[model samples]
Target: MRLEEIVIDNLRKLRRLISVRRMDDAEEAACKIVKYIFEDAPVLGLDLDGTIDEAPEFFRLLSRIWPGRVVIITCRLDEDKARADADKFGVFYDELVTVRKLEDKAEAIEQTGVTVYVDDQDECLMDIPMDVTVLKIRNEGNFTDGKWLYSGRTGKQIC
Candidate 1:
């Protein structure tokens, strides 16, 4: 991790150690951490099941349109299976990162150096670093409301 990230992380740990009474401090620490994580290029972090295969039209359009900017991030244990499925479905991406935990996706997104992330899971998007723009795509399985859902049609607009 970078120096700023380490300092921000220490602040968060300190906030936690202090008490739940200092919620504002925790929030501030989180915001500082987020502020430090934003990258230069408009890289994109994309989810697998619902964000891609479940929404065929969006995936088809994205693969043709922004093939180079995409980095597929999934909480799939079997990397091989996920890659095979992506290949079978013709999903386009510059790279793929698989994680064991759903929440850990934030770390993968951070690692991808993406400024934007498109996903179906609200849980996954919740604690992602602040600077990243989250485009929560609509999927039948994960949709509760339109809180984080993207208003625009294309991936370019999303980025």
Candidate 2:
């Protein structure tokens, strides 16, 4: 059966369980549906400016470790230049999604199927889906509200 057919069937089952107040069953089914929908490989989403370019050395190491799992999501207007910079710094990535606008970041991330998204902007994190883990990489302008899933120092400032 096609993926759409499976999804529709799951939705119908989920609705029936919800209607009967079978909270536990509905939750379990929801989890199973989520697992089946997402791809197996964990994709790491990285911001271009503060996360990657700011610490090229760190990303260089990350690229070595993760290889093709990294996906760069950026709001940079010039995609070619952004890609060129990543290549120059040896920051490996399987995909580069140029967000172009702040509002489009979440949509871009959702489409890419990243498991974890790392960015410096706190507001952008709010737009991303709950299923995707948001890692708030520490920076000069980071939010201290503790809203995101994880916070840590990533990358090194090359001065």
lDDT of 2 at 75: 92
Native-referenced Cα lDDT, model 2: 0.74
Give TM-scores for every candidate, taking all chains together and pairing residue i with residue i.
0.61, 0.61
- State the lDDT of candidate 1 residue by residue for 1-159, as single tens digits: 885766678576657846766764564455444434554447778889888888766674565345246788988999999888877776666788999998899888887787888888777887789999998777666445753433223212434
**Regions of candidate 2 where Cα sits further than 4 Å from its true position:** 1-39, 143-159
Q: Ten residues in a row with the worst lDDT in model 1?
A: 147-156
Error of 2 at 151 (Å): 18
Worst 10 residues of 2 by lDDT: 147-156
User: Candidate 1: where is the Cα deviation over 4 Å?
Assistant: 1-41, 144-159
Q: Tens digit of lDDT per residue, candidate 2, span 89-127?
A: 877688898976866889988898887888777656767
- Distance (Å) between predicted and true CA of 63, model 1? 2.8
Provide backbone clash counts, one per model.
Answer: 0, 0
